[model samples]
Target: MGVVEALVGATVFDGETRRHGVAVLVTDGRIAAVLPEHAVPAGAVVTDLGGGLLTAGFIDAQVNGGGGVMLNDGPTADAMAAIARAHRPYGTTALLPTLITDTPAATAAAIAAAIEAAPTRPGVIGLHLEGPHLAPARRGAHVAELMRPLTEADADQLVAATEAIGVLMVTVAVEQAPPRLIRRLADGGVVVSLGHTDATYDDVVRAVDAGARGATHLFNAMSPLGHRAPGMAGAALDAGSLWCGLIADGHHVHPATLGIAIRGKRGPGRCFLVTDAMSTVGTEGTTFLLNGRTARRENGRLTLDDGTLAGADIDMAASVRLLVERVGVDADEALRMASAWPADYLGIAEMRGRIRAGLQADLVHLSDRLEVKATWIAGERDEA
Candidate 1:
């Protein structure tokens, strides 16, 4: 009989707290235990990684595409696989492949493909339908023809259809989503996020009360916060409980503003980082088509040729590095931003975020330079 335990020697970061020099034990595809320095388990497969830092594998609740596949351009199981392969080495363990606003048939097809893919590919969480329910005034990069105001029937049918197919997230503008849609989704086990909105502070309060607990991409694709009206952006900024996703690509939100969001949400449900990356993410040569527009990479960011905010060209690691280097956040804090916070927002914190015992063995190893050295998921190391 063979032992099924594995040991990750030396580097460890518990994801929520701080770093440690420990040996992480994995057995039967879950983290069995974590032993401290100099503690060795007999007959275990030991991978002596020396001094590389290891933390929980990143979970992106929002991802569109990577490698060469755009989930929006006919998303499929293969597309999801391509996305995962592209992001895996970059340190993402699991992800929800998002499909931006498109026709109903297209949306339904993407949902079906995601359902078909989810069982086979554990890397994929589900599908995030980012629109068809957005305020047209703030429909960033999304096709205006596909945008629709959320009505009761639209909400009901969408919930039913997506729930039936295992798709579990939707992003809507508070200003346009139906009266109690947020509450209903929250109750129905769907994660709701606010974006592409122009709601006033009062309207935001109403939505929060109705169960919208997260803001999509903080300051982008929504009304900017100003002193006079204190738009939805302000409401999100001040909402201590809301999970704010900041694109740390330096283009979406400036580094200074990123610091403010981190400061504001630094408590219970603090800020986090996301790639919000588009199709060209993993491909070389720096160009891809977003909704028929040609997006190019310039100065470490991705955008349309005329400079529309297309999406991030960076990966989760770059976002983390930006936080540590530019925003002056400590490495452990930045690690939490990329791992734990986002996991908590999706309500999967218990499973994949933190590097605690009984959690899934989804972990990333980074060199001193903050580059990805390796990644492991459920006791198996990936292509680094």
Candidate 2:
């Protein structure tokens, strides 16, 4: 048997439900078991979490930048590692280093960096290319000039990327990427998502039929849910197979609006929280560059000079807290949105999203108030 350690003194939520007086056993960087505290095996090392809640670490799929490093600014393995480190303190154990609306060459560089980093960087799971193939009408902070239709060559490149990285997610407008192309990418193992579009309800349904798995930051860059015209937002809420990424920063979406969406969201694919964080997270910097334009961070919002929202100024822990406190979400469900739901959306739930036996020992310990006190990735404590 490998070296065994028992984590105790906290209420445990094993992704599905909560249990008290249980000790989580870790061996060889995987969960060994979750049994009663007194049932801990003989000679196993013990560490008390000091009265808190232990749950699976948060998994974010829409992280743009962190640790003063933007993936677009530095599409290298080191930058990806830096971004992961920046978010770890905030309870994010794994994240996709997102590249937003950059050139084709830049996208290639980001993919190469992700392939290079995935083996060594446990936190950098994959890459999220969130544009250049999006609609100019809803280009929030993306360079409109760089936005273009998805070509066969672009589709080929994205499909090829899926073979190299653990996950390759591409966000495109339905108008630019037709159902056929979406089907091709999905068949090639890419997690196709809809965003930055003026697409109609029919457009979204066609994409979903073509295997588009999710909506990027629902109701922000996509078309709104109108009573007469049910746009992408309407389709997202109505579609049972599509996971919606919610930016619960209280700026991109209102608390009440998020509450209603949470309550009305369809099944099999619920709304999950994503940070959409920028380089300002875990830093004191008040401003950063988004495609060469200045994005100012003030009043808990990140926006361009023209007042266009750039990305989010929040972290995963704060996002969960916002949903629970402001949006009136149950604490357990909000925690699921931050961890389990995103892991399921990324198809990585079998690996690290839960505290079940045989899963990776990725965990976060939070105070009764939901603030992160410490985190463990692969059974190792994050001292940074």
Candidate 3:
């Protein structure tokens, strides 16, 4: 009943299979149909994509900042919008504006911001609170002093946050957030992910049993996979229900290690790519402040003065390309990792993650070589 538009001239991957000679029809901000090119409605407005690949847009679950804005510095709706806008050019049509470990006041502000922006910002889906509750030993770039045990009041606030934000992902360490608390958060509809942890296999098992559905940036800040210990990384790989986020940027993870993890990972809960990006992304800035510490960008890597990896400088398109070209994953599967898998991890698969009829028309136009050319969020082309 609304204005209809047909996106044509590109090979379309509907998050499952690729098809040629088809047009994706959009109406009322949702996908109306995916039909043969010649069958487009007579009155529909048609936009040619110029012979690239049209697929579901990338959905990043962990995004710290972009467009020279850090969520921690200003946890506001505008900041969330800016971050989203920056990534849109790189094919990320949906993302969680993530907050690194910070004060309780900052955390509250981020929740409020997400609540306000979730409805207005098409690209911002929710908020990812990466921690104030984490183990000090594995606290990569997070201020160790700020890391503490999850309090009762904190749990209550987080549960209340889920009601408004709809998808609040909280990363915690088992040592900081107990299994009982994990269950409480899960019951409150909070997506609990284990991260910045030094937990052994048994510890991770308990957390997984308590409904911790994911692992954040697998194998980077967590315990390594030792033959005798079988730490969080091992448990993450062994557990079929735990979806893990892998930072495919070569600096964060080695290609050989990534290859091994991808091949060895089990079913139902696949290993997906996450940027774990920072403020420097989509900008030419050389450095930024993280928890009052300076993180410099050099040689395609972001690192603190002391040489600890802060956050990635890569974008979603580059991540997918790395997975396929360097890590040896199938191109389709790599794209799924950036789009479908993360949407599934956030429990929004039905609403997004695919180019199916009835889903939101969030799509990306990428060249055959995997460079992003344009993006569409909710059926509107992002000219930014």
The sequence of per-residue lDDT tens digits that candidate 1 reaches over residues 1-384 is 234454555467887555466778777678877876566576777777777787899888778889877888877888887898789888998888888888888787887887788767757877788887888899888877788877776667667755555547788988678647788778777778889898888888888888887888998988888989879888888877778888888888889998887877635767877788787777785777777778787777777666778777778988899999998888888888889988888888778898888888888888888888888877678757
Kindly report the root-mean-square deviation of model 2 from the true structure over all alpha carbons: 0.9
Q: Mind giving the per-residue lDDT tens digits that candidate 2 earns over 1-384?
A: 788999999999998999999999999999999999999989999999889899999999999999898889989999999999999999999999999998889988998999998778979899999998999999999998999999889889888878778888999998899899999999999999999999999989999999999999999988999998889999999999999999999999999999999999998999999999999999999999988989999999998989999999999999999998998899999999999999999999899888999999999999999999999999998743
TM-score of each: 0.95, 0.99, 0.99
Residue 12 displacement (Å), model 2: 0.1
lDDT of 3 by residue, 1-384 (tens): 799999999999999999999999999999999999999989999998889899999999999999899999999999999999989999999999999999989999999999999989879999999999999999999999999999888899999889799789999998999899999999999999999999999999999999999999999899999999989999999999999999999999899999899889987899888999999999999999998889999999999998999999999999999998998899999999999999999999988899999999999999999899888899889753
- What is the C-alpha local distance difference test score of each model? 0.80, 0.93, 0.94
Q: What is the lDDT of candidate 1?
A: 0.80
Clash totals, every prediction: 1, 0, 0
Mark the 10 consecutive residues where model 2 has the least summed lDDT: 375-384
